[model samples]
Target: MIDRRGFLRLGAVGGGAVFMSGLYGKAMAAAGYEDFYFVQLSDSHWGYKGPANPEAQNTLRRAVESVNALAVQPDFIVFTGDLTHTTDDAAERRRRMGEFKQIVGGLKVKDVHFLAGEHDASLDNGAAFHEFFGPSNYSFDHKGVHFIAVDNVSDPGARIGEAQLAWLKADLDKQAKDARIVVLTHRPLFDLAPKWDWATRDGEQAMALLMPYSNVTVFYGHIHQENHHMSGHIAHHAAKSLIFPLPAPGSQDKRTPLPWDPAAPGKGLGFREVEAEAKPVAYQITEFPAMKG
Candidate 1:
């Protein structure tokens, strides 16, 4: 039900289950797994104004259109982070956050969730984001899947800190070993590249807490590319951005944002659609280069 580039052709089933297509298909209904789909839209630098991406203002709208056009509507959408670019001015920060909320309000799916990105937190240490969205960290349950939205970007110097870690431990302690868990955050939870600001300081401790779970997947953003890693059985996957992309870890002399490539229009600007409501997630490249260079 999908083509060569790996897009999903949703095949819905009764009783909350769905089909996923990529190079292969998976029922995604094994071991008490219920099926549902969600979209991950990350790093949409809404207030950013620059030539790095001329379509900066329109990119988020384009991403929304793409998701709206999907054959099957996602049960919900999770914007991983970086909803707005950072600025030194406080009023501008509030303006951007308000504008972003207005933009996000247009999504067809009402069950949308937002998290913090360093860009959104770079000013006032996430006060603006908290005002627009609710608490930076929280958890929810849907269709047998337990999701934890951790706030790793709100604190300066990039860390989960001890208080949140304790809360995480208590939260996880209540869950049964067989429960499926997914953690969403704005920063990678490992030492991807500390020099490039891609690594989380106390992420080691957070990982230790999650290490006890048999089914744990960390879906994060900030790196803005399709990359994956593993800390033991836990799989860490990076979702592509709705804004411009950044270079690979240590790929350049310094970690600089890559300009929108006209040749590979969709090279770095797209959201992720996880089919089967879970893994194996069919991470298809979004619609063609949405905007011309």
Candidate 2:
């Protein structure tokens, strides 16, 4: 049921994350035209080592292979964030970023975008991340759809802050009221749970700015699982992580990594596909459970 395939039908489920289906198809699209689809990967946490994910490097490699092997090529691929695990040593961080980029460069998809997660922000307020991936916040338009990526995690307080908000407003101001907008960032724009470091301190301001748009959807990562929520007309969807899945928000007293289970090695981990050309965007998600090796 989780891997349903089709287009134009989207369900907005509740409880912290969003789940969507119908992003990838095996058969060729009808001649003369085709729908738009792109793959979303998040929380790769490269350079991480521990029992939580004993085979971290291989998992990342397999993830690339999985996307490359998709029967139909995704229009593009966007990594939501946490590309590298936290490393305090400046040189080490650069090394990790270089390696992460090198590995990801192997992806068959040519157009790839990256975002910065908290771990990536650990060094110099993400100066290192910028050094590796370029600007922390920006936007682009593709096939009449506007995509915006915000940096809400780098701030020590976990805030989108004022400058970026102004940039977002100016960017939105250029678009027509009916324009279709997709927001990409490292964390949810709404307060899923502030106590758990899950909510962006100033996200509400950003949400308020997007309210007037006729069609707006947010695809973000950080929760490390599938979640969906609606803010008025806008929909916010969360994607699963490649490195490891975190506990569901507020599910436990303390935020801790879900123990890597040999029996369910790939559970709660996967990628999402979005059908952007459809009237109402439809998405399909796949979770990878770790396996016994």
Candidate 3:
């Protein structure tokens, strides 16, 4: 059952209320009875140094601090992608990744999962990213949930390709019919915006691979904002960035980073907290800047 109070707080933001409330209620109600709770934080862009966010250096630190400070520590943390900004120098990339590690160094948690974004992978097709992080795509089983991480950013176009698809099928075949499945990627499976190359080229194939599952949820990053759409029984969700926000699809003729409003500088760094087990629970997204201000 949805938490009426929490849903109302999330709904006050506008169109996001219904979806946000529904997800929270559904996840929370299944918490202890179903699965574990985990937090997703994306697009930290650790190397991004700019005045748009004066506290850029400390922003990530603060965000990690907030996560650590949570009364209920999540089972794990998933950083969807964009660990660093685009860079040609290998040393620079290493430095950025190192900084990210430093920020989360004190966190009292276990199991951190990472995915690579186009910015982090496109430069050299994830050569540096993989060296620091592990395999670009992989899967693991926790409790009754089958978690699949797909690599869409490091290629000619955003695609899972044939090798990964085959692995996905073989992996799914091993799980039971009632098992819950969750997929993580840097790009949405649907054509969110073809012009910006935001949509994945082989996403349809990836979706087909997952269609056989009874319960599935796909989580992505890259749009730097939150969006939810239902395709069949599968729920697709995009997370907010820890660095900056982007204009909604078609909201602007050309996509560009939105300027930080002086009155709401830290607004973009907010994130969603999800408990995805059997009975899931999530908090009303607390906008850090708004709350701190």
Write down the lDDT of every candidate, Cα atoms only. Answer: 0.76, 0.78, 0.73
lDDT of 3 at 180: 71
Q: Tell me the spans in candidate 1 whose CA falls farther than 4 Å from its real position.
A: 1-33, 263-265, 276-293
Residue 219 lDDT in candidate 1? 83
The full ranking of all candidates by lDDT, starting with the best, is 2, 1, 3
Candidate No. with top lDDT: 2
| Candidate 3 global TM-score | 0.84
Q: Give lDDT tens digits, candidate 3, residues 197-286.
A: 779999999888787766678888888888887888778888888888888977878878888777777766566566553444322333
Residue 47, model 2: Cα distance from true site in angstroms: 0.6
Model 2: which ten-residue window has the lowest total lDDT? 7-16
Instruction: Give lDDT tens digits, candidate 2, residues 133-248.
Output: 99989898776568999998789789988988999999999987766678999889998877888888899999999988866888899988778888877788888888778888
Candidate 1 local lDDT, 1-293, one digit each (tens): 56322334332221112222222124343555555667778888889988677767788877777677766677899999999998988899889999999988988999999999999985577899888998899999977677999999888889888999999999999987646788999999999999888989999999999987776778899998767787887778787777788888887888777876766655667666664344443323232232333
